[model samples]
Target: MRRLGVWIRAKITLSVLFSLMVFFIFLVTVVITGVLFFLAHFFGLINDEIAKGGIVLPIIILISCILIGTTISGFASRRMVKSIREFIEATKQLAAGDFSTRLYLKSPPEYRILSENFNRMAEELGGIEILRTDFVNNFSHEFKTPIVSIKGFAEILKHDDLSREERDEYLDIVIEESARLASLASNVLELSKIETQTILTDKQMVNVGEQIRQCVLLLAAKIEKKHLDLELNLYDYSLSGSKELLNQVWLNLLDNAIKFTPEHGTITIEMKRPAGLLEMVFRNTGSGIDPEAVPRIFDKFYQADTSHSAAGNGLGLTIVQQIVSLHGGTIVCESEPDQSEPDQATAFIITLPSETSK
Candidate 1:
């Protein structure tokens, strides 16, 4: 059907051009034939009947050709112009966010290709639009949750009937909710900067082992509270990157391990030079990520568990991945259900290129 439309459109355009050419030829033929006939009559080169026939024949031929040409031209021009107008209109509709609009044009192969390209573009636009809408909706809901909790808690604290302990408890709840909101906002802004390539990294040579140690220290309280065993196998390995961003990577990973790992579970950190690359691995006994969620683990605002009980805005892994990419490094995760232990075992392996390894 589409092919037929394209052919019809092409035919129409050709017909219009042919019609114009015929009109031009008709006019020229009539003028030249008239001049020749007049010259012959005036010079008496031919008899009156012959001259008259000559004049009449040329006029008759010119008139017949003009009529035929005009008819053909009109038919071709109409189809061609109509097809072009339809195509333009369809394009406008698409530009106006109507992805369903399609150009049913009968044109040549070139025009058919154009239509196909347009359709493909529209399909991509539609998909992006859907993603944008979903992102916006999800963002709004995420933002609203903390704000509502903070507001409710603040209002409760305002009541005079509440005792000192009750007021303090309410204020604590408000403070916690406020912190959650702040964290969410920060993550959103950071992700935007990363996506836009606006965030600059201050790269420098630093000890990767020390960075892991710092991260473990930061989460030392939580690890102790959980009674988790901490193990470190550090070698003299270093990496060149923004220390602050790299710290965030370690902090988020270690934090996640502490959060998910059960009591008495073990968390291990290892740094070594392997195959001319600096490799850092953080492993923990925790609930292994579901196979379905593994692919989306690094996606911004994506939580494997939708309940939001986890202590994160779901942007931690995303930030880690982005930082690693900025440093021209790679990170991977391996996990298995630890049936022998009380929890699953998961390991995150990070490899920095030898050129950047110090």
Candidate 2:
């Protein structure tokens, strides 16, 4: 389909040139032949003309017309080919990671449109390249930090003179850093796996509200540790999709809510079906997300808390977003600073189509 669309748009110029060249040659042949016949009859020398060359004039005129028409067509064809060649070469450069290449084509609406689209694609590729480079740098730093901490703490533990309390603390720190490293590795692998999936598999009719409740219960310990108040208004709801994937969505969101909410903070989970949309919202009270960070919160390796003080590798929300996308859903986050709103605060809302839509 895409190839056909391209051909339909690009073959107009060549088709017009070919048709015009054929018409020009035919017209010249007819007019030249008729004029020669008339001149021979007017001079009453038809027999003399026949003896002299027998249609030689019309044959010469026909040949000249064809040559002229061909030459003109060739020039037009060369310009068209040159422009196409430029597009091909630019595409090759782009494929080679040269996102800076841009087209500056002129004339012919089709070629102009092609150039504009290609340039826009190049610009997007350039932006993605930048994001990829930044992700790699951030990933390396994140991966190195935990490993270094573990190594440093282990080295300290090697001293026999250290008291029991000091040794336990050092060992705890090593254990915590090791866990962080493992979590980071797991999130990376999970994100890679989910992103490569084009369609959701292992789908089943899952009680989504029950799933959210289970996620909240699973994190009950952490919620209790923080002395946070939890509210669940989960009306019974079910969705037809990959159960394991949806489980990750709820788990990640609830875990994030637990991680970021302050002690004695409030966390609320709500599920409802409104206008054929299965909407779930997780709201938590905290310092609130930076307005600037809200837009990029789902981006991989982009953390609102850039200080790394939070125990996240920034892939949780990314994974959540991807899973929701695979399920043909949308997730959005809105935040307000402390005291900017009533008791309710920063919220992440996810909406999925009803099972019938699926």
The best candidate in terms of lDDT: 2
lDDT of each: 0.77, 0.85
Stretches of candidate 2 off by over 4 Å are: 1-14, 21-51, 54-67, 356-358
The digit string of per-residue lDDT tens for model 2 on 1-358 reads 9989766556556457568656765676566656866776688856555547858755765675666556655765686689889999999999999999999885466677889999999999999999889989989988999899988988888898999999999988998999999999999999999989998768888888888888877988999999999988986678789989999999999999998888899998888788778999899998898888899999888889978788889899999999999989999998887566634668999999876422
Which window of 10 residues has the lowest lDDT sum in candidate 1?
336-345
The ten-residue window of minimal lDDT in model 2 covers 8-17
What's the TM for model 2?
0.84
Candidate 1 clash pair list: 5-105, 5-106, 5-107, 6-106, 6-107, 7-107, 9-106
Task: Give RMSD to native, each candidate.
Answer: 7.0, 5.8
